[model samples]
Target: MKTPGHIRAVSRRTVLKGAAAAAALQLAAPFIIKARGETPLRIGMVDPLTGAYAAVAQNEVMGARLAVQQVNANGGILGRPIELLVEDSANDVGTGVQKARKLIDRDQVTFLIGDVNSGVAQAIAQVTNEKKVLHIVSGGHTDTITGSDCKWNVYRVCNTTSMEANAVADLLFTKYGKKWHFITPDYAYGHTLQKAALADLQKLGGTMTGNELTPLGTTDFSAYLIKARAANPDVLLVLPQGSDMVNCLKQVAQFGIGKQMHVAGLQQELESLEAMPPEARVGIWMFEWYWKQPGVSGVDKFVAEIRKVNNGKVPTARHWFGYTSVHTLAAIANKEKSLDAKKLAEALGGFELADDVKLQPNKCYYRKGDHQLMTSAFVGEALSQPAGDPEDLFRVDRVVAGDKTAPPEAATGCKLQWPT
Candidate 1:
């Protein structure tokens, strides 16, 4: 009941009308104050920002932030500014979950983009499923994300391990006629990748000389290199990420693998090789999402912008992946004009960005069956540039469009489905 004074001030007609309106306004004030405390769009990011894949994580963050900037510049999403909340997982599994919880409970983020490592992605997926929160994985691409553990709230924006492993492995065998041996880390990323590569190699009529799974912290590859040397395979696919890749490639010249081995995957990322000496990383083949090649959508502008931001030096390929992932988030948020996680996940199935080059219409989609994205993968070769500059070390040798690499539906073991 409002006071007589409030009733009188509210209206001439017994003041009942103004009393109700005044009471409602008083009630709304608390909600308005609380809303003001929260960010415009609660986007939580968990990544290995301080550890092995920090460079990749940083690149991904830059890309995501760029999307946020672009979206806000165009009058923001649904007329509301988006605020991205980031937390470092330090590449630790426990930290990944902890950070995710903070994002969900404290930051109140409606959606999330993730840890650079597959392990971190896996852990976060479990948490989101349990909490019924949405997770859009931009960096992690392990099969497990879309595999057995794929959850209701989880959707991936990158290819799975099975996709890359089979695609790259088969590509090498068909093109290079592989008598293959592998040098991969013993951890999940390396092992899962090696398994897929080997399977594809065998399917393509290639002989697998053998494989050696080096220890996770094996800084010195002399022993592993010695083993690889003994195998004498035509293809030497290195599956290590982060400093492991850079370190191993540096010593590969001494092992003479460069003389006879065909490098692919991580060994072929141009930025990693730019730090390497000639012959140490040349003719290296690697699979990727985008390169500054003509006809590839969004590549030239993205590359130019990144180069401009990095001051003429090129951003790491991982940076571009992060870049694309960020824009994807903004698109989903802007398309349905909602910050709600479920709506964004549903919108993801048929989503397309007018500016997205790597993802094309109809052809590009998130596999409703497994929650995996069908993104084009590029098989690139390291250019033998004398300058060995970070920006000029590699060029797209082959355009392995998404259509060429995707396996038949009967092949993948995914059981879950999404609406058309």
Candidate 2:
């Protein structure tokens, strides 16, 4: 006979081998009492660990792992060691829901964080909300996470499509050109970003020459490249992400289209860019975080530590998302003096954290109306001439304030509900 919410727990130090090993570790007692007389603070994380987005996902998990170690080293949250139980979402909506339920109902995780795919994130959100568990969207970028589909217990750390579009439109239009063409993934996320980008660019006297809707995980973009080249737009905005992004850009360069037209996009992940050769990496794009920005307190220390752990490989924005998500939740839990979902929700509303980035008035917060994290958006250009270090790929040119980047609260259509 096994008890409910019983999953074998592993310490922060153990490396989870695979899904089976991770599941095997979840035997009974999801919330394990340590020999130190303090119960563990469990956090369940689900993401696409082995799929098109696996490289980016790996960095995201590393970020969370670093944060967990940092939190535990500092006496843990509220004097209890934090235990992280991870599940591979596999980039499938059904798998995401199953994992979410397992974490909530069986593992009894204190809260949840996840999901790279917007669709998968939404599916997991439903489960966490039903279980009354607080979840932070650490990587998902679809507008619905903080829009009409928002839930009371859910929060988003990543910028919405509108946020990225609004933030970078003017900069890109002015710097690149006013005439644009799009290479978008034929999916909800791509459609949302493409629509937002077009709308924002149009406001600045920009015109869309063409938009090529490519299926996700497309390998050969020769046909799309031919269409984009013929359209002869001033800027080619590649809107697909993850492997789609890597593939399209590489093919674009190979097709010699990049040489004729300026290349750009809505968002970029350093991990994704690292996968491509320097010759293949070209374009100006939106970046949520950069490891080498100047005058930021604790950034150098973070970069140094991550580099040490990853054999001198620098951390990326995805890593920061995971690191920030865990630390922010733990901080809020400590501040509210409890991990109750309702209390945490109330505390997060209008809560402010002073970030050292120095770009956004040194502060970021969750909007009371939408639970969207108000933070700066950065524009980075892949350097044409490498200054030697392969990691020194992008040169961050501008950092837009969050207030200036995100749309007005009334326009977002998020109606948050609080407990009685």
Candidate 3:
């Protein structure tokens, strides 16, 4: 565990320095694509390319593409060109599982990455582990992915539900009052996030005024908005994400409840912010990464590259997850000189992330205990006024080291079943 004092929230300047260092490491990486007359190493990526989370998933795929391009340019991994095969899970668990099998069994991909939906990610985890193929999830953030349901072949590059919850809970309570009402989704992702948020709130002497659980793919939030208005809590914690998140915030404005209480969420992404109207995008939430925040040495270069490919649009944290997961996987394979699932998993067990990745100043790493990538946690507040840059949606407010946000290993109940 990090010492109690290790996780102090920092200012933008300090965070920028950290970002610069990380980006510097990235810029220094060699990009030579030498051919060694070897067969290409294939990696299968599964994501919801056309659904509620399509925007975020598409950005993730773009990130992965950039990583592959960079690795191939760097003489390919171990002189073998990397080939990526993408499958659309459409945010469904059964479909995701089928796609996973196709990728592993037919495509014969040695590695796998992706899935925005927690349920789909969990299902894919089971498939990948059974096949003994190393799967690195880029966008899935369920606690169980790194907790009780963790598999040796499955690893995550995103923050867990608990980390997301604790990152902003204390700050929200401190800035706004403790009485809270929740607009939670009715699914594995929503339940886990809500539970984590409530636990953190309670720890900080906060109380839950009410909760309205809405079904997934909900279009109309009228009934929930009415109930939330009645509850009139200090903070309205909306936990639905992607299109649902955009819809909920829009409804909050339509209901005129934005002025009545402080609005917040367990997580927020660049896609949702772009989809949201300026009037509806108010409030504070946890952000996995923000492109404009300077710290890593090569972040500006990344942002420029992404913007060029994305038609001048800034890349979100989803993109970072995709890019980092692929690059990290490739780096490990090169270091170990093997793609054996067990060897790859072991290589990543305690691997520390370089400073050029837009996280905290402290070195981040994947905890061997749970296979969770521990990085810095940031809280962002959506701006109500025009910030000139359309991508300038949020003003980053706080930076907390991952060590402080992550729960202690003993508390996670992750029993790794590595092959003996």
Residue 371 in model 2: lDDT: 90
Local error of candidate 1 at 96, Å? Answer: 1.0
Model 3, range 1-420, lDDT digits (tens) per residue? Answer: 000111122231112122212332242233324467777777888988766777777677778767877878876677787766677898889999999999899878989998898989999999998899999999888899999998998889889999999899988899888999999988888989999999999999989988899987889999998988898899999999989999999999878887899888879987888887888988888888888766657778888877756656777898788888888888888888887889889889998876555334556799989999887777869886756876688888777788789999878879999888
RMSD of 2: 4.8
How large is the C-alpha RMSD of every model relative to the true structure? 12.5, 4.8, 9.7
In candidate 1 the C-alpha lDDT for residue 307 amounts to 58
TM-score (C-alpha, index-matched) for candidate 3: 0.90
Which portions of model 2 miss their true places by more than 4 Å? 1-35, 354-361
User: Number of backbone collisions per candidate, in order?
Assistant: 4, 4, 24
Off by over 4 Å in 3: 1-34, 357-360
Give the RMSD in angstroms, all C-alphas superposed, for model 1.
12.5
Q: At residue 364, what lDDT does model 3 achieve?
A: 75
TM-scores of the candidates are: 0.83, 0.90, 0.90
- Tens-place lDDT per residue, model 2, 1-420, is 011133343342224354322322332223333427788778988888777777677667777777776667676778787777788888889998998898888878998999988889988988988888999998888888888788899998888998899878887899889999999888667788998999988889889999999976788889888989999999999988888788888888777887899988889887668767677788788888777776777788888867755656787888788888888887888888887899898789888764532223346788888898987887878764668766777887888777778888888888876556
